[model samples]
Target: MPSIRLLVLACVIPLALGFKELKHVSYTQLPTSISSAGAELFQGIEKGTADAAAYDWVNHVLYVVGRTSHLMHVIDLTDPANPVRLFIHQFTRGEGFPNDIDICGGEIAVALSANREVNEGHVRFYHTYTRGSGATDVVLDGYVTVGPYPKSIRYTDDCQSVIVANEGIPGKDEFNTFVNPEGSVTIIHNERTGNPAVQTVDFRKYNTDDAAAWPYRVPSKYIPIRPTVAEGTEPEDVVVSSDGRTAWVTLLENDAIAEISITAQGLGLVNNAVRLPRKDWASKKVDTSDQDGGTHRRMYAGLKSLRQPGKIARLRIDNKDFLITADQGGVTSFTNAKHGFTWTDATTGKSLAANIDNPELKANANDVGYLGRLQVSSLEGKLFDGKNAELVMFGGRGISIWDSKNFVSPMFDSEGSIEEYTDSFFHDIFNCDYIASTATTKSPDTNKDTTSYRQGDFVSGLDVADDNGTVYMVVGMYGTGSLILYEVDTSAKVPIPMFQNIVRTGGVEDTWSTLYTNKKLGDLHISDLGIITSDQSPVDRPLLWVVGAGSGSVSIYNITESLPVIPGR
Candidate 1:
């Protein structure tokens, strides 16, 4: 065991200076056979390897699922310093790819998407504990068919039910026409029983005239050319309440959160979809261009961003429920250039600059030194009044904390702080591409460039860990391959997120090939994060497990705390 460091000034410090250190313990690279099978399918695309991870505290095991590999690699975590691979469970060819996983009450449930995105997917169940040394030790329990593209899954706190979020992304058919399935939520009751009752709740009820009057940005109303009312609203992730009576689903594209009522009668009712507030870049500074000289951040006059949260987690503070979201923005880019019905919700700042009438905003958008390469949404702030037009971007570019009671706006947002920290600390690789760019690559200073810093620290994964009431947040950046730790103070009226530390996990080396060849300690493109506390860990220390999709590796870290005090105090 490593020596534990204690903080001398525990109470006198301002708490903002109090930091948590993440010590890299060990890492294991998944077999190439598991990650290389479907490599040819997504040639130029940055595909995920170890997508999601679920820890079984009872067995001291970690189960990691590969998104494109179609396999689950199980590892024994009895020794935190040295992890051992136990076995691998391979899903059949047509069974589908595992998207997300969760463990509860000696049972493991995996959300799987079909071979085709438009087809119906399923939730497969298995035993978490291995009876023997073979792969068959993990017995197959059963499976329940779910909606299209089941993106995320979670087991209720009670372990009696399982909730799944069906994304229902649109896909082209044999005739090349788009087939959009209605997004839905699947709830499984008596999951441990032989015959489980399944209830798939859809958003069909909200497709009416009454729902049309809602305040949120409905995709159908904004685009009007693609999916209908129900089909346009896709559920990205689902988190359940402590009592298991309510579930909040993140509608990423719709810029809203759907509250669902879970009942004993096997019915999940869609109570309401509450729209989230947008972030005004005019007040919050953002790095709008990769062509700008070395992470240049400024407040744009007309730039606003939607908080299109990709993943969500619930945290309880002072007996009140707060929802934390990783606002990873997304855009719909389906186009048929031949049919002339080509419509995309996102466009470059240069394109919007050509259409808008604002002279100052137009000049900024036209100049590569400004916002020409930035990607903004075309759905909102398009005022054709010749005087003003607000440029609405796609994502919030940071994490947001929202009051669960009131979903109207966020209690606190790490606006520009994440970018500021990354730029100051990681200037050499600031805003570098996770897949394409190397660690030696630097953001262009003066010349007009687009690829290097186009996508700033794509905040993709986040998890909240509590160490004896001291709350900490671990934010995973997909673009730069970094992890940021923050000490969250929620006792006051509004929670204050204090910066602790930032560690670069993936981009320590020059290239992915060299990093992989050398068996690098950190991997790229962090897709998901899981935390095992001291009480839950077999090694009796808190462990942070990071799943890197770009490099096909799982990096483990041992967490410890330190308190820095003011000189007088």
Candidate 2:
């Protein structure tokens, strides 16, 4: 029989051996410059700058998309410590706004939104490295027209095709009337060839009156003017299967996922759409009120949350594929005060209390420190119900992992871990909004108001890396500009995610007055993250690249095993 001391040692030794830490190694800022067309780029620095980034493992090059800047900045990461800004490629006025970018097979694909989001967009292709004599010269292979508001772009694992998600957001026309375009997924085949074939898949077949009977939630409120289910379905992000045979798109506003089958001829077939399960807060903890003084998490019965995922990534474990989502919720709200037209699917709890029939719920809604300040989706709930009203909120407030084969329920969910982690280590700035500042309208420190501390941690960017046989996941907190690392153990019957370490990459200052100018490793609003495995890294170790939209900076960190080796064998 094992002694008590030996049993204790066995448990303690594994805990100590599994320790890990993220060490900040290098940082660089995206430069703001005037385009050749004489247009000033990245002018609205406060609005955000860097939006997305992609890494080239072969050449050790990094490509960053400038959201407000309308430029693509290329940097050399040969030396992990000192990243060199190689050059910048400016997109002309006709190219539109670049939202996301992906690289494969020495080719780069960029998803660009039209000048008007409702109009048609384009996907421009370029060489990863400049072919021209000049270092700043960029060689454009060609461009293909895609659906409106192209938000995400990715290359298939085989590098034979590129998939794009066209958001197709509704907007007003010259007459100030709403024009809602049908959202779609565009597949470009033979991308490496000079001429590529394009095929766009739409949801017209699901626009019938019986659409309500469909499996997914087709909310009519998304497009009030034209409530067709096809136009209401917006694709936020897309991820392709490892074998490049299927693709999944996240319909954030609708709380659904659309699966499309990809053909070898570059065509896409809309197979099915499944609704994500809503989380019941009755058993889970959530901090619902921004008016609450500090991090006060509580379980509220009858309150449900939508897992409106903003980003999706595919991971293969034991020959099975799993989809991970960053449930950063969103609401459809449009206000044209001049035109006296205001439409929204969101409302404050205080305003909703008037329609609540339950006595206890009504009281909680009225109390400023409880649910009064929390914003919830009005599209749901029983506002019309004479007796009972259910509270439906946006976002899962964390991450969820769903089996690719089964979309009904998630295999694992980090329901309250994100909030608990932030509250435990960053209590001073718990649930802090990255954009909140004294100069902005959402300022929390203007009069020493602590409302911003209750906004909750917004998990935005996520990526997974495999070090040998061990799988690891990294999550980026947009609100606080922090990163959390978790080790995914697949040896169990069901995969288990163990929290390993959390690090604050952004400024630690409690106030926004000095947060952006404090010269931190990373800044606020982490828009995207990429991981370079030890095999692909120049330093022969794992590396994490984080892109900050608020501060327009790119930060890199080294993932090191913090466990000390035994003195002797």
Candidate 3:
């Protein structure tokens, strides 16, 4: 489980006592050594965009939570870029807008759902303190009801336990159509609860293995009824395992990663699945250019890509266990895209629905299993090998590593290096609103779609997180409104990174989000991440916080520690 080789000096190291050493380079792409301490230092709650953050190292107070209004803002970071908001927690009537929040010891926990309804979800809990109380009377000391869309929340450094990720999407109707549900994870022991002790878990026997009727059948005429292979599967992110009873969850539309243990005879699934990996895109390394022009976004070799990992981070390294994905690639609304399926161009073996104008793939087509959206563990004749057997698209824009024993082993993958480090640091305008999403932005005459667009630095990454508590940063959350940072692994031997910053917290200039802009501030597509550690952070280190559903704003980044200058030193 240790082979990865990309060579640029590769490996060599000797002369320790006489002092020659130096060789762990790391940085597969765009990172031009600029950490004038990585500027910005702090950018408080611009009114809304802050999705899930937590801190209170005793009373420094930070607890954010608001991706789209519904409120819960308590800043006062002792003053980091003018933070002092101090109070505002009116979720008013059974939660739903808050996406994630967590704080241990004094206890906080948030996570709500029902934005669309299927499990109607919930997870509230509070009590950060009340001895001297009064900030408008803070309430809700317990609430439990989870399943539908509960996004993220955690606590396990002995806070007694609490976790939630219940993504289970699939709730649509009113003629919009959709309903998958099955994704789960919701524990809450709270020292043996008397009134707050739920435990959901579910995975539908791990998605039935593989049923068939031409893609999970749903009024299928040719495929495209959206076969999520059943048990619906969705669950987005949850970490927890420094021995805290194990929990991993991250089933981003099933690229896979599941575990969930919580013992003493409670929770379940020690390995619901593991999967992950698909960036073969012929091996150009990756840049999945979808907007023609940026020179067709690289990824060479034989081409085929897929690395849809979103939000999942866990670390330990020397005691073994590791993981850090955020390949951020997702999409699914399937309900007859005009029913296409029945092609079979297994890379030219022929019959792409008679190749009329190309488009017959019937939703990804799981490696020839028909009905597809990625899950190819084998097959090559009908091409499924590294996926992209031909056409290409689907996340992995960068940030990966796993081997929590075997979450599909093999580590380090930031190939094409974060779109060549966002083409040397975003001057703005890249991925121009995601251009038809892949296969080199099209133009082979597949009818009218022409070509020549722009935005191609390749960001699809959705979420990933890390924080050793005091300082060991590793985050990647980018649906384009950036947040990249890396550098963790001082020892324990493997986890070598070197790009210290890529900040863009709020997606400016390319526009596309409006998210309850009551106070106005939007564009940080991030999804989730919240870090803390500080007497001041920066050179004192640790302070990451990101929040981006509608991007109302809350983008703090400061993880400096770059120093590398050895060559003839």
TM-score of each: 0.88, 0.90, 0.31
Model 1 residue runs over 4 Å out of place are: 1-18, 34-47, 131-137, 174-177, 208-215, 220-225, 335-342, 384-388, 435-455, 507-509, 562-569
lDDT of each: 0.75, 0.76, 0.50
Give one digit per residue, the lDDT tens place, for model 2 in 1-569.
12322332232123656677677888786655576686544433345468999998877888998766777888888788899878778877678999999998888889999877778999888878743335674578889999999999989998899999998887865676677788899999996677788999998878766745656666644544546788888899999998888999999988988899998888898998888998777876778876676668888777788888888988887778889999888877666742225677778777888888788888887887878887887777764454337777888888888888898788877767677666666666667664543533433223222432233676889998788877888999876777888777777544566666777765544345444444452556789998899888888888989988876888888888886322121
**Would you list the clashing residue pairs of candidate 1?**
293-445
lDDT, candidate 1, residue 544?
A: 88
Candidate RMSDs in Å, in order, are 5.8, 5.3, 22.1
- On the 0 to 100 scale, the lDDT of residue 394 in model 1 is 80
Q: Over the full model, what C-alpha lDDT does candidate 1 score relative to the true structure?
A: 0.75
lDDT of 2 at 340: 29
Candidate 3, 341: how far from true, in Å? 27
* Predicted structure 3: lDDT: 0.50
Q: Poorest 10 consecutive residues of model 2 by lDDT?
A: 1-10
| lDDT string, candidate 1, 376-408, tens digits | 776677655643387777878888888888976
lDDT of 3 by residue, 1-569 (tens): 22443421132121122221111111101111122464222222233445566776666666666545566767655445455555666575456767778878777878887656555687777877433355553566777777787877788778777888777655454455555566678787763365545677775553433444211211111133443443456777888887677888777655677777787444555455665756664454433323233423443333344465667777675577677776665534333431132322112212221322224442323222221222222222124233233443445556677777665544676666555544445523344332233323321112111111111223433323344432254454333555555444335466654454555533343223221222223333445555555443432445555555433455455454444322221
lDDT winner:
2
